[model samples]
Target: MNKNLRVPVGIFGIFLIIAITLTYTLNNLFYLVNFLYIGSILSIGIYLFVINNKYGRHLVQFTIGLYMVIFLGIILQENMQLSGFFYYLFLGVFQAAVIHYAIAKIFGPVLFGRGWCGYACWTGMVLDILPFKTPKNHERVKNLGLLRYMIFILIFIGVLILFYLNVPNLDYLMFIIFILGNLIYYAVGIVSAYILKDNRAFCKYFCPITTFLKPASYFSLLRVKNTSEKCIKCNKCINNCPMDVDMLDNRRKRKNGTECILCLECISNCPTKSLKI
Candidate 1:
């Protein structure tokens, strides 16, 4: 096998394991099919990326994002949002939303960092098409990240209120929230992108999902590394990074390291090819 193919194969194998395990444990064929579909698409995207296809990441984003947002969320009425995760958790149901959160949002980050944000996020799929792929201002706004925490807390509280009130037709309400929440996210994300001149402005400042994604991703097994010997200090990697990660630092605590989506812009932009996963 070619060395470059290893990562994509490994990714597919991991998802295959998850699919088989969940199918057996939960006695649901949907788990097997859903995960297999997602795994295949992701593996193809990674292979395209390895071959230096510039749109590989976007391809994955649209395929998986549209499936989750349109098929699972709208057609199946599964919600698939933070509110839906909480609702399913409260009901003790190990369904689509719960399984998705567990695999894609919570525990999965320990291995892949914010790969979900880069390759599979429905919100990011839309945002990445915006004009500002790289922020005009290379620095993040001070203290704006606190808004994610606030939004996280508010979602939790709102879910609690629904459960406490024993809201009738709770499933319907959650589905409604899912639609409205996505609309609001898209609206705010687009507006913020233009205002801040950054495509990921919403992810940086307002996404409640990051509150779950960042901590585990800090210890992610996959991360970009820099080879100092090959580096010419050209700073192209940093300048090209959408997340403003200090990829040259080669430390777990590197500036904005937790924010890295493993997008590989730094590697692609490196003049000396000093950066690698």
Candidate 2:
């Protein structure tokens, strides 16, 4: 077996376990289909990444991102946004957005790092398509990163307020909020990309989900590590990274380490093939 194939296979196996377990426990086949589809796409993307396909990551993004936004959010009216998660949480419903947050946004990062941002997030889906791929570290606004936590807290408080107020037509309102939220995210993400000259500007500066993701992904098992022997003092990896991760510094506490999305841009750009997951 090719060494590069191992990670994809491992991810596929893990997704299968999650899918099967959810299906068995929930007695709903939707869990099986949903997870199986997600797992297959992720495995395929990782495999293509191994084969050096430039579109490999984009393939997964479009596949999963479109489904979540179009099928789940619009067609099904599931409201998979951040508000939706809190909505379900306050309602004590263990379905839909809460499950997504638990599995993808929160706990999953411990295993895959910020894979959600890289591969599955609908917000990132649109942002990745914009012209700026690499980050403009120089132009990054100071203290703007604090906005993410603020946004996160505001959203939480908003949801809690709604719960306290006992709003009527809650389901319908959530669906509407889902649509509005996506529009706002797209608008902000795109403008920020152009303004900051960084495609991931919104992610780095304003994504509230990072509040959950960063803490757990700080201990991610899968991340890029560089071997000093093959490193020729070239800074290609750092220069190419969209998220500005200091991947060459192999330490748990490396600068911007938790920000890594496991995108492998650093790995492919390495001149001596020294970087790997």
Candidate 3:
């Protein structure tokens, strides 16, 4: 939320305002609405790279807000065909796109990492704003983390099997299943986080996005690093991590956790400036 970033952020906001207004006021040329929407999405994506300030996080939030509004518009379309229904997938894809870009700048770790997750994701947003207590630990189920890859394997196999079986409209079914999968996956993550007292336990184990994104994030240009020289071993970073990553342990071991989201909560909160990047 640095003051310097405000101007660009404000400009981006204004662009979105204009786009929405055009869609509503210029109904005669509604096709332009999609272009306007894409423009806004691109603006928000670039805003992340423009402003290193944490306030850019809200760009992600606002994008989702815009997406949901447009999603309802699409869903409300008259005579909407199944093809039209598929556009709903854009909601998730757009979020992924934002993260994909953000990670690219930060040197890449998907699943929205700490930057996009803390800022843009509706599910993560809800969890962050919730008036409740939650734990951040994976020690109990750390071994189970491998299950996500297996889940991915099963999903891939299922898609391949359906294709081999000559399933009609398999693409449509796959799209539907993908949409359902995101909803169910996030729902399960949120509910499980509530029950298990861990905010990202399910993300660490069950989320296919995390499964795929984690590796991609590993190869990403940007990554979280520990500046252990200043660490006082306060353990705040570890305790505050939504993904249950033990930053202190990583620092101690001279390693970075693969699950690190680069959320910067650790860096911002670190009294010693020991946790950074």
Say which candidate scores most in TM-score. Answer: 1
TM-score of 2: 0.97
Kindly report which residue stretches of model 1 are placed more than 4 angstroms away from their true locations once superposed.
none
- Candidate closest to the true structure, highest lDDT: 1
RMSD of each: 0.8, 1.2, 8.0
| lDDT tens per residue, model 3, 1-277 | 8764564465456545655665566453442454355445545554564455555455555665345323522343221111222332332333223322333323334432434444444455545543333364436564676787787677656655665687787646655664565567668777877777776656566754454455465554445566578777887766665565666654422233556655556666677878655
TM-score between candidate 1 and the true structure: 0.98
The sequence of per-residue lDDT tens digits that candidate 2 reaches over residues 1-277 is 7888888899889989999999999899999999999999999998998888999999999999999999999999998999999999988999968899999989988888899999999899889889999975734578999999999999999988988998998889989989999899999999989988899999989999999999999889888898658688688999999888787789989878898888888888888989877
Steric clashes per prediction: 0, 0, 9
Off by over 4 Å in 3: 1-59, 65-123, 126-142, 248-256
**lDDT, residue 21, candidate 2:** 96
Worst 10 residues of 3 by lDDT: 76-85
Model 3, residue 203: C-alpha shift (Å)? 0.7
**Local distance difference test, per candidate?**
0.93, 0.89, 0.51
Between candidates 2 and 3, the lDDT winner = 2
Candidate 2 differs from the real structure by a C-alpha RMSD in angstroms, to one decimal, of 1.2
Flag clash pairs in model 3: 106-222, 107-220, 107-221, 107-222, 108-220, 109-217, 114-261, 224-277, 225-277
- Candidate 1, residues 1-277: lDDT per residue as tens digits? 9987998999899999999999999999999999999999999999999999998899999999999999999999998999999999999998999989998889999999999999999999999999999986778899999999999999999999999999999999999999999999999999999999999999999999999999999999999999659799898999889999988798899999999998899999998998878
